[model samples]
Target: MMPQSFETFNNIVNSSPVLTDRFSALVQDTISAAREQHGVDLTIEDCTAIAELRNATLGATLDRDELDRQMLELSSLSDSKLKADIAAGDQEAMAVALQKVNAGKEVVHYERSSDDRARRISMARELGIATPPPVQDDLRSRAEKIELLQEVKNPAQRVALARKWGLL
Candidate 1:
């Protein structure tokens, strides 16, 4: 049985001609490459998974683009705010403005990191690399595992969980 969320996403993609066309092209390419390069006949499930990864990578690209635009806007605004704070000699306001700028930079950094990971995973899938199946553990629900994974800041730990989920 298809998960409800995936069914909904599929319906949304189907509704959009552009998205449907893109997915069809990606699926065909992946299928052909897998057959030729690995002598592997991909199942429908494998094709679907690869398409989903590609979609996610596309989303991350869009997100990064938007973040770049936002950062530019924020930089312009911050420059004006900093100048005003400096002219007014309000050290506290200047500090606050700088902090906000730093926060935005941090957000951009995080988003870029996420986008890099998505791109890597998508590329790996496209190349027909065999990903390990998710490990079976009694302690954590899928949602909990995902939540924990996101909270982890350590690169090694994050990679471990990503691999466990066949995302690396």
Candidate 2:
């Protein structure tokens, strides 16, 4: 079974405005499944926010019109009037080009989150891309390892366990 990351879950909500009550139930089920199967050690606060923000950024398509207006207002100025725009340096352009840059950043920030890497992985897998499995949850400690190894009597099993635990 594929794992759903918070990011992919957010995408599902954002992609559709008309979600059903069943979607909430599904999210809960996914949260349970991820916790059980994927070893995603999230704080309660993180889980709470993930449940809340599942739809929070849905309508967050940065106001491109406002950005364009800002740019147009800047462009309408005479080159001599705006010192920042005509400093004959790319840095100057960058300083004045904040409107588009900032809005584009908003789109990117909306599209992904550090907390959503799992969801992104899920999406990638859905697209038929190969994804590495989540790192295994190794619960064995040194003492536990020794205890486990003490029972290895068969030669083949010993070799297999040794290779698995890097004993050889």
- Best candidate (score: TM-score): 1
Residue pairs with backbone atoms closer than 3 Å in model 2 (clashes): 5-118, 5-119, 7-116, 8-119
What's each prediction's TM-score? 0.31, 0.19
Q: State residue 52's C-alpha deviation in candidate 1, in Å.
A: 5.5
Predicted candidate 2, C-alpha RMSD: 22.1
Off by over 4 Å in 1: 51-168
Candidate 2 on 1-168: residue-level lDDT in tens?
223565566456556655434445434554464456443333323432432333333433334344323323322222222333433444555444433223334344655765355554453344223333333438877678767878989879877776666556
lDDT of 1 at 39: 52
